[model samples]
Target: MNISTFGLGYVGGVTAACLAKGSHNVIGVDVKGEKVEMINQGKAPFYEKDLDNLISQAVEENRLKATKDVKEAVENSEISLICVGTPSNPDGSLNLDYVKKVCEDIGTALKYKNEFHVVVIRSTILPGSTENVLIPILEKASEKKSSGDFGVCVNPEFMREGQAIYDFFNPERIVIGETDKRSGDHVAQIYNDIHATVIRTDIKTAEMVKYVDNTFHAIKVTFANEIGSVCKRLGIDAHEIMNIFCMDKKLNLSPYYFKPGFAFGGSCLTKDLSALLSKAGELKLSCPLLEAIIPSNQEHIDKVVELIISQNKRRIGVFGLSFKSGTSDTRESPVILAINRLYEKGYAKLFEKGYEISVFDPNLDKSDMENLPSNIVPLLSPSLEEVVEKSEVLVIANNDKDFKRIPSLMREGQVLIDLVKVIEADEVKDGEYIGVCW
Candidate 1:
């Protein structure tokens, strides 16, 4: 495959060398004469582990070349990979000037080209950047429609600095966000021999994957450091603790609590986080991320309250009472907090003229009913159908299998505030349904 890489910086240089090593004809395009000259002379513009040798080998073998001419590069190559830098602005947003300029140059070069060219953005960008910014520029400049006249994709690079060559060849996953199937297949061909999982998705999801990966990595680092800080104050070995913690692959280092749903609320999570934050406070150590956990949870509860309040309905039905499904425990339950707020706002007044709140949970019996607020009417409904029939709005608070039947039982005007997304979006009308944290 003929490939052209824009911007001969770290990402581009490494990508070009690696692709050329894979036997793809790679042409590196750069504005700087020195960088272009260096690549042409079988020398790497920057130093990276095994990168210089790879570039020198590829150039010497006539599999790689460098030039300042975008037109020539575009004319010769079937695919162009944009590897330009998107540095941070003062306000913390991405500065996409380099990316935009390179796109324009590529688009202009595509004007005279008769063959279909695939433009893959290997640069790190925000979610909608590819479709909202790059595609429009390419279409206007080339006077061609994407997925028709040309192909476009957002194939984010996962290469780490200093270990660029290793990371390139041994990527954990290859993500291809394409405008069309042809574009995706073309991009996927570059990794045909590489042993990695190939994920083909929409352009926006592909763009956001890079940010999500990087931000999660940052969070992991800060989390470990905060734990270390608290451990050091108590003369405990944080490494030993983390080693054990990570050993629990079933829960700790797995996708156990990673789902996007309601705020975490159980006997352990809320209590443990509070204890950790308090210990950090006692040590006079500031752990912003750790400290913000509980407050962020409170905000999630508040958001549910606000969503319910926005409906302006008086009669409300809550499907579950426990902190989670299959349990009767209400200690630190987010649903309970939301219910409390609703009662305070006169949305839970049972016998009053303003509101009526009815709740039904298989786990909640007469004894459990005694602990709830006086305003919350615990319905002795033999079936969930009875509760759904009476309430104007239904809130699915837990991931119980019983609540999954609610979507099928939904009435015409009834609204569902779903914290656990058991109901499919396509199953209900758009305005009549709301996902709490989706």
Candidate 2:
């Protein structure tokens, strides 16, 4: 591939040198005359590990060169890679001035170039930026329809600063997002000999993947720091704790709680979190992340109450009233909060004289009956059929085996408000199959 790399920064210079060493004819372009002269003289413009020798060798072999003229670079190369910087603004938004200016230059260069040239953006950008912003700029400046007269692709780079040369040669994955199949295929051929997973996706998803990887990295760093702070205050070794925590790959660091659904509430989680928060307060150490956990949990409970209020139905049936399934402990149960709010709001009443408000739980203990509200009824239905016949809105709060059978017993007009998501049944057709957090 005849390649022209723009913006002779860390990523650009290293990539041009490596590709040139791999026998690709490369032209490196930049606005700085000093950098161009340095690269032309068989010297690396930027400092990187093992990059100087590679650049010197590529330039000496006549496979790589540098220039300031964008037109000359575009005219000689078959594909151009944009590696410009996206600095941050004062208001925390991204400043894409460098990207916009380079796009304009490339577009203008394409206006006179007769051959179909591929423009690949290797700059890190937010989602929808390539299609929403860059494509329109290219279309306006080139005076040609993209993918018809030329090709465009976004190939995001994932290189560390000091180890860029190593990362360029050995990447975890290569993502190529193209405007057309020809552009995608042409861009992919450059990595024909590389030993990495090649993923071809749409432009927006490709653009977002870079940000997601970086943001998740930042979050992990902060989380570890927070744990370290708490451990240091308590005279405990944080690294040893984390090492043991990470060893449980199934739940601790894996996809155990990665789902986007309802809030969590159980005897152990709620009790442990409250104790840790109280300990943080006694030490007078401000742990914002730790402090926010209990409130965030409370917010989920409040949301369930609000959703029940939004239904506007007077008659409600709640199944599985305990904190969770297979337990009779009602302390801090989220469903109790929902039921209390409904009773206070005048929308809920006790079971009518003959029309019993049906409830079922395979694990509810008679000793825990004191936790029930004074006004609510406690008619324990042994079977789901009797429960389905009594209430208009069914709230499944637990994952009991009996609750799973309630969906099979569901009538047409009854609404199912699932908090634990046990049944695969629709409540009031499609509109009322409400999951508490789904």
lDDT of 1 by residue, 241-337 (tens): 8998899999988888888888888789989988888888888999999988889889888889989888888878888878899898877788878
| Model 1 CA RMSD to the hidden true structure, in angstroms | 2.2
Candidate 2 lDDT, 94-142, residue by residue in tens: 9888998999999999999999989899998877788889888988999
Candidate 2 shows a clash count of 0
Per TM-score, the best of the predicted structures is 1
What is the C-alpha local distance difference test score of candidate 1? 0.89
**Model 1: pairs clashing at backbone N, Cα or C within 3 Å:** none
* Model 2 worst lDDT run, 10 consecutive residues: 348-357
Candidate 2 global lDDT:
0.81
Reference-based lDDT, each prediction:
0.89, 0.81
Clashes of 1: 0
Question: Which portions of model 2 show Cα errors greater than 4 Å?
Answer: 297-438
